[model samples]
Target chain A: MEILGYITLTIFVGAMVLMLFRKLNFPVQTVLVVVSLICLVLGAVFRFFSEGWVGVILLPNEMIGGIILHPITALLAGLFLAGALTASGGFDVLKVLINKLQKTPIGLAGTLVILIQLPVIASLPCGRIIAAALLPLLFAFGFEGGMGLLTRSQLIVLIGAFARNAFGSCGPSPIGGVGQIGEGFLGAFFPTASEGMLRAPQAFSLMLGTALTALFLKLITMKLYPEGVSLRDLPEGSVIEKKKAEAKGSFKGYLSLVIFVAALLISIFQPFGKMPVQTILVAGGILMLFMCRVSIRDLMSGIILLPVTAMASGFMAAGALASTGGFEALGNILKGFSSVPFLGVAGMLAIFVQIQTILPLACSRILTAALVPVLYFFGPAKFDLITWPQLAIVMAAYMINATTSCGPSPLGGGGMMAEGTMRADTGYIKGAFTFSSMAIMAPLAAIYMKFLTLSSFSASGVQLGRDVWLIIEFTLVIFVANAIIIKLSSKVLSEDVDKNWLSQLPAFVIPGAMGGAILAFCLYEMAFLRIIQGAIGGIIASLLIALMVPKRLTPAETGE
Target chain B: MDCGTTEWLTFLFLMAFYLSVEIYQVLRRKEGEIISFAGPDIPLGDLLGTRANVRMKDGEVVDAEMSGCTLCLGRFEVGDRVYVCKNRDKYVVSLPLFMKGRRKRSDFCKSSCRREQASIQGL
Candidate 1:
């Protein structure tokens, strides 16, 4: 079984190499499916045959009644939804509208950051997506803002946003596929969701801490180098040929817009109770298909296999490492190392080392199986502080791991960001270090000071559940409000500005929509389905608006 | 004298160093660098126990081979020179060696380390 695991691991590595180096022109979809199957089989074989590998497999019994369910299945569902929303013209309209709004390089950067930050609480690409979607926009704005190939200030914001979203109270941080696997393992190993409500002030402070960190960093960088701009000015890019606004009064055009909006709303609120996310996804997909008359061929062609393949590979590798007692062995080894005054520092170092070698998801999952069990050596008194079974330390790990771009994982956040944004460089390394020091490390120190020392805060037993939900609600509200503001602001601003000014707005508006959409998903988990009826209500609302609006312009008069 | 926490910690740090070295080699190879050796530097043929015969891109056939080096990981054939990076990082040059191939830097660079070692020894 161990041998089989090794073989599967090899195949996974080979597949990545082949794809990356262009050794094979295989469709990414086919590659992922084949790789996933190979990994699953290998894991199953190893679990049954290898005595040391018992920890790798989630027993059938466990899955049937487990808290985590099947991690791969959940991940696939999330990917399918995100992919569908992306492929359909749903996000495109929002992107277009946003581009028409911000009108300045800084505004554009802010808008793009918001868009990339939206999928904070669910299955979205936090770092990679931002890089892919926003980097080019930043490049275009760069010339106008006096920024060049690499703007240190802009990189700081990028890192800040990545760190923020990666740890945004989401069930699983979106650092990469590795994070998903690690989160799943943790959920399975400790299958209890503690319930209770903490004071609203507690929630407020925690959020303020994170947000203030982001805001401060953003402002400092902006002040230091206010001229950083987008690469949209590059002559290398083919200029977008302006298109006329067609079907101004056409019911079909309005209907398409309504459907897109409806899908966005439904994705956020999930109107139907106990309805599979896929069901709503498929319905929205169908609306896109028929409303736009987009063929199934195009849909299939647009499907990407990178996320799925990465997810499966991570699951198998982590599973193999866990079950083989590799993590447990490491934990035993860590136990032999005595305590220093700074347990947090030691923990961080251990985590950093382990991740490069064997740890997954910043050791959030592995720690339970490995580190927590070895807490006896530290003495029972310090156990609670370090074990972090209370979810505080777990949460910290999620934040640190969320950016995943910095570490040694061959499949890491940095790689994902590079791939998504098509701009791969040492900028990410700088971003990681900068953000870690500014956001994660500094705040972590504060948290340690407040909670670990000078108070019995750990024993306060404050119900964090309510606080968490409120933060989720607040974040969602901010996203939606920001999106609407960007839209309205851009429209008003564009009327007074020339072509160049109008072009910058979309960068901010589009990211605002993304952030809004993600916040909506977070809201949905807070029992929002009871208040809304999913995409249908939003579609209906849009349709009614379309009927009432006056149509004054013809398609030809709109543009060239 | 004991394998206590401090000693084990030191050992772990060394282990990390070893791992980093190996990873760096792999990275160099992946990035397309040729492998080279120092001290008892052996040629590719000697490392691999097999000679490489290839026609160069410029339509020239080379018949030279390598022999035993001071250290070797596995088999490496001739017609491969050690590709060096801008920072002078060494890697193994394989097919179309002159035309650029993937880097196959080893985790261990005895020559580089030896230089440091000699500097320390002299000191």
Candidate 2:
């Protein structure tokens, strides 16, 4: 049975790789469904004498239902809201705001800063929508020299940097799908910590990791594209035209945007009763549809626009993997390395990250849900060798990596959107983005976890030294190693450089200092209210910016 | 055998079969040629609306001006072939076309569509 588990696991992994590389052209839903049915039939056949075919069939059905209900349902609601907003031209408001930024006196670097910061600050649950809206503006910035003094390659780097930052930060949003999934898994596994207690710290840790990774990637982009490349560098007619129009959004569109913002704030702060994020989203979407005069039929059609079945099947596969003892078998194998602490933990995280990256079907949420339990069950609990904080570091690493690692694969989700919108080569983007993400994220995760642990210990009046020192040392070593790796890799993979190596000094120092300050605040004084306040403040600031833009440039006129 | 062991063995067999099917599909494909099935005539309304009733047949699709799949609602590019289901009055933009792949024919857009078709056929 154990050997059989291993074989099944190998085949599953192989199938995922084939799909990712486009060697398998079948729909992902088809592949997953087939795999799942086969597993069910085989299980039934094997257990016929004991449990009978009826039991086997019913079990798998129940498992599928369980997998689909909570996270997938929530995700569907989010997707529906995103669709409605897009249909109602809510995103056009942001596009107009971004366009107006081009006219601002902020230099190329400052414009680049706003571009990078916009998505991170907006932190909308639907990443693809955000990417779809912004990618063209980024391109326009590159081609029309919106990055004022910065060269073309710097623009690409900045885009990549923002992509990494925006996607990684999803795990922290209190009202986002990824955040709900991460929190669900965390609460399930660590019963002692209430969801509320874990929410703020998890959000802070994930956000800090993202900020640090963004800073590192920015520096690397500077080195890699010392001479910048621009849209003109590409063959003529290759650049995709901006999908949204240049006119200011309509009054209704602006109102819809405001409602969406208000909904997110109300969901997060819960000034009234505790409303589910999905409920808020659904209400906002309906209100937007009515206000924007979109037909109900169109809204329903928009809801089904996303590949919900494909994602649901992916979750089903995760459930199957768990039910079949694949996770337990892998966990048992990993247990041997736990005695060595760093090697075991790091190895497991690496495997999880690799699996999440290659397996288009294994979404981060389901993957985390399946694997974290296995870790808790098989970890070094007997000796009490690993502290909860250390385990948190591991969980944080997995959570951060699982969310961001999918950015490079052109399979589905953000990767497909990024490739389609940016017109960049998926293969090249995958390699550079994944490598840069791991280099920055892995160490930053350790540092953030260490800070979290120390803060907790200090609050409890407990002295901590050995574990903290070890983590700090590990972080420094990992940081240096990744820096060396990136520097060398850039040399071999460097693209065309057009501009003089203008100082990325201001760009680097300012963002770095700001990110450091934010991380410091999060570590010491962060609270749920503070996070909500920040979100509300960011929304108001964005709305104020939108109001300043001329109405003529909105997407309604431009046929977005 | 224990229930757990029985479950594991069943999963393994299923995975093996799935792997074999995938390998066979890969080996059987004709290299360097895009495979597209000729679909039946689907009205423009059916293609644009949420519900479609077009089916795939040997004949060329006529009077079915290309558009997004009724099921998935994704935009279709020029030269992209789609799956037309006649009995169910549904049309799905082929997965290959949707993902911009070079190979494979227009079938159900995804597994759910295939399953829906099967149920409609009382399979």
lDDT of 2 by residue, A310-362 (tens): 44565666666555655556666655544344333333333443344434232
What's model 2's lDDT at A279?
Answer: 64
Candidate 2 lDDT tens digits, B32-64: 221222221111111112222222344433322
Which has the greatest TM-score?
Answer: 2
How far residue A333's Cα lies from its native spot in candidate 2, in Å, is 2.7
Candidate 1 structure quality by residue, lDDT tens digits, A8-97: 545654764564334433333345445555555555666666544553456332222322223333334344434444444444454454
Cα DockQ of the candidate 2 complex: 0.03
Name model 2 segments beyond 4 Å from true.
A1-4, A21-23, A53-58, A65-68, A101-108, A144-150, A189-230, A233-245, A302-307, A336-342, A345-373, A379-389, A410-424, A453-560, B1-123
Where model 1 places Cα greater than 4 Å from the true spot, the runs are A1-69, A103-136, A144-270, A338-389, A406-424, A427-434, A437-560, B1-123
Best candidate per lDDT, number?
A: 2
| Per-residue lDDT value at A435 in model 2 | 46
The best candidate in terms of DockQ:
2
